[model samples]
Target chain A: MSTSKFVRQGFPLWLLAGLLTACTTTTVDEFRQGETGIESHEAIVILGRRQGSTYETREEFVNCVGERVSRGSGAIRVIPEKEFVDSLFPWFEPRTAPLRTSDLQALMEEQVVADKIEEYGVRYIVWVDGQTETTNRTGSISCAVGPGGGGCFGFGSWEDDSNFDARVWDVSSFANVGTISTDATGQSYVPAVVVPIPLIARVEANACSSLATQLQQFVNGD
Target chain B: MFAVTGNRKTTATRSLRVLAVLGMLALLSACGASSLVVEGSYPTPAVRKIPLSLGLYLDENLRNFLYIEYTETGAEEYRVSSGQTHVQMFSNLLPAMFERVQVLESMDDAAAAGVDAVFAPSIEEFQLALPQKTRLDSYEVWVKYNMRLLGPDGAYIADWVLTSYGKTPMEGLLSVEGGINEATVSALRDLASNFTLSFGAVPEVRDWLASRQNVVSNQ
Candidate 1:
């Protein structure tokens, strides 16, 4: 091919490569310790663990996972974190929440707590704990407006890493049926010429989907 | 001659408008204050009420507690009015935990009348930290409470000091006032959770309950 023809052909390939690089890499792992299955009248509650000093399991991620797990084939009823926590009130508050399966035995002795749990027909408690962080930022785009006009002219990029872990507790048996861990990482770019165009990666969303899928399969005994 | 007067009047009117706008801007800048009120509501706890009539003394100081802080330059002021939230929290949790509760105007008035016990809850100390000031990722609030328990005869039974800490992650879009209010509400929830689950474990409280049981058994 001629040199001019070759150069023109390479531009599309470069663009394709840039688009692909914006995709996030995700992985989901599961560890099962007991049998898992849900009944027609049973529901699962998903709560985010927020005890970490430096990081918080974002509420948005918890809601996303709950919405995901509540739909599709073999879909089960899922209780929202806020509603479930509020329904239980002080018992499920961060300061008083049970940290171990064994603690539930003591908590259930409260009578009121046990009664409420039974009323909700909750069979599993899923505790999600994780956060998404953006780091390794590079490049910068500067834009200034003048009396005449203004435009951006530079490139900026950053890496996003999302790590999450979910533990499923069988309320009836007071056992941790299994645990799921998910991780997603991606690079985002903003190549500005006149107007800044952001090719952002959906790291947190990808991780949520991966985790929710695994949870559905695990709950259905797949 | 007519044109000159008309031009002068127009200029004077324009100048006055400009001065009025400047004055309003100056007033706004001079009053750089942040006042936070708790917009969140408390959730009722699911607890078996203790089978004892009680009198609760919620004093003015505890009902209208406000924390104020100013920047070193005194150009900006931060205020957290947590009194209403704390009052609502106590009101909700106490009724859930006790069979009968009488709101007392003063400790002396009802402490020795129509109740088996009198309970008084007060804020001892409250502290708040900003992310920029503490180099932390969250805004934090710390509260210390003095829980006073009294017998039917207005005699002091126990004075327990309880401490609670709560923090909310700082977000890029969350304002300082919103963060402060969130942390304060979190701290209030923490206090209620702790007091609810563990109050019976206190030795004095346990003893008082046992004594009441003994008296009831004799009766």
Candidate 2:
């Protein structure tokens, strides 16, 4: 191959390589930053996450909260998803958009008064929400030259990130109880990459425990 | 030609190598790429108790269902379908399942009748698993009852047929002697205990409320 030919071909390859490297590092840093902003809380109301027919994610959160509460100082009661659905009718249902502060306040007042009269001892209620994202990319090439300059080449990369955000509302008076968010992101240069299992697990467990602690404080009026 | 060909091959090979690495990385990243994120908040726990009042005759029946096995049939089936001979057996049994609360308050017929609300026990279904004749005719019964508490404001509380079951002796003279009678009673008692633990008023709450009232009186 002539020097000019090599330079022409190599320059783009070098640029692509630099871009790939930058993208990889940038994604990793983004993940780390995403992981950092997670806020902590003492108490939280967990809502249901559904896919077709399964609410596995929501169930997991419930279990996580239950375990954390069981280990902590205050009492914890899990409101069944059915009850949450019922609450939505009067508070979240009629609304055309995401809940407004006034709507939440109204819910708080109604629930608190009704609960106090019916349950007498109930002191608070909590709620939560979550979201996730994924992406993939690939490239390939093959070529052959007998007596001429000919060769085929191909390249590709894929990346994915998952995030979770949670918010809490006080049931007694519809106040913002607390909020938290956690994220786990990873990328692969190969056909496949091992997800950061340890990282996801750590963040989920930590966030749950942190929320439990916040709930304890709320109950304590701290 | 050789040098040019060699350089071309090297460049191609390097590019392919990078692609292969990227593909593998993609697969690896996607491999368990799925995540489970959970957020939960606690709700104020609700505590309520519905009293059972059917006079002494029904109360005794409830006690019997809690302690003894009658024949090889389960209490839920036997009691529910005993027909007119039993009349409203569940009405008799609902109060019995709540023996703990009644025991604590000594709520007699007069007190129950005067209460602001009452829950009528409704039967949903009764299932019986009986032992094969060779196995001594032992059988298990599962009974589901739906109950609704009516106040001046209409239905105030409801519980679906929470199931309870008992096993009884299937054969010999034991079946004739009512081997299941004891089992049915025990099963009923166990069911009652579980229900109370889950939804009944906390005993401590009652005590606290009483003490507060006493303090006010003292003041």
Candidate 3:
């Protein structure tokens, strides 16, 4: 084979491998207590656990999960976490939110809370707790500009891991119906010559998608 | 040679002017104080109201409170406008906890009519922690208040410090002012929730309620 031809073909193959390396790997684990199903009129609420001292469950991630769960035909109705928490006010604030299934009974005993719960027809309360962390970083890229112009010359790679768990509570039964946990990990690279090219990893997005899918199937009794 | 010297002198003068302008801009930015205002309407609590008409006195000190904290060298100032929002929140909170509340202007007015209890709440301390100081991704606020529960005859039933805390995560590009404001509102919500859930749990308040019950039963 001619040297020029071999170089062109090998370059495409190398780029393909780089792209594949940027992809995320996700795993989901689900545990259901028993047969589970949701009525069409009922709704679900996904809330992020935010009481930790070292870390907070990101609000954007919780909303992403909500959006993912509530898509497509015959999609489940979802009550936004903020709206539901505000409708109940002090009861559902981070400090006062029930930490266990048993606490739900006492919370529902309040007449106004009971009435509001009935009004929303909320069936499941999904409590998601976790954080997405940039695990490891390597290499460095530096750029500068002068009268002649400048560019970056470096190749850097970093890993991100997203691990999260969701606990589903059946509001009517006042019991925890199921739990689903998901984790996604990916490596991203930035290689620069004249300009920097980023092969970004969407580990957080991957975790959200799979968790939402598992939650939907678990709730719909599929 | 003369032309080269003149060019050098001009270049140096222009550079000095640029440096002076940059220094002035820095000073101006430091001197300008930032104001934080908390604004979130409190929701009516769902707890059963205490079955008694109450006299509520929100004093001017609590209504128009502002805290100004200056740096050690006094180069910058941080002001928190919290008093008005405190009034707004307590207005909703007090009504929800009692059967009827009469807004009183002074403690002397508490002696006027058919009121069984009175409450006067005041700020004790306010503290703010920025992310830069804490080396954390959160902006936190702590609010301390003296919750005074008084009898109709100006007797102190209970005087206790009710402290609440709140923190908001400062992700990516959120402004420090917005983060602190969010934390303040969260702390206010927390204070309302703490008061609502713990009112009957406070020892002095519990004793007073029990005494009131005894007197009613004896009657």
For all candidates in order, the CA lDDT equals: 0.88, 0.41, 0.87
Residue-wise lDDT of candidate 1 within B1-219, one digit each (tens)?
999999999999999999999999999867877777775677887888888888888889998998887787865488788888887888888888888988788877774568988988999999999988898878999999999898767798878999988888787535887888888888888888889877888899989888888987899
Per-residue CA lDDT of candidate 3, range A1-222, in tens?
A: 897887866768767655655689999999888667899999999988877777878989999999988996547888998888878877887788999988989889889888998899898889999999996799999898989998998989999999999999998888888899999999999999989989888899999999998988888889
lDDT (Cα, tens digit) per residue for candidate 1, span A1-222: 997897777757767556755789999999999999999999999999977776778999999999999999979899888998988988888777899999987899888889988998999999999999999999989998999999999999999999999999999899999999999999999999989889889899899999999999999889
Give the TM-score of candidate 2 (chain A).
0.42
Ranking by lDDT: 1, 3, 2
- TM-score for each candidate, following the candidate numbering: 0.89, 0.28, 0.85
Once superposed on the true structure, which residue ranges of model 3 sit more than 4 Å away at CA? A1-21, B1-29, B72-74, B211-219
Clashing pairs in 3: none
Tens digit of per-residue lDDT, candidate 2, span A96-186: 1135446555434554335532342333344444423336655543446668666445444455443444455454454554554445444
Interface RMSD, per-candidate values to 1 decimal: 1.0, 12.3, 1.3
Worst 10 residues of 1 chain A by lDDT: A13-22
lDDT digits (tens) for residues B63-101 of candidate 2: 222212234343222222222212233333345344332
Off by over 4 Å in 1: A1-21, B1-29, B74-76, B111-113, B172-174
- The lowest-lDDT stretch of 10 consecutive residues in candidate 3 chain A is A13-22
TM-score of 2: 0.28
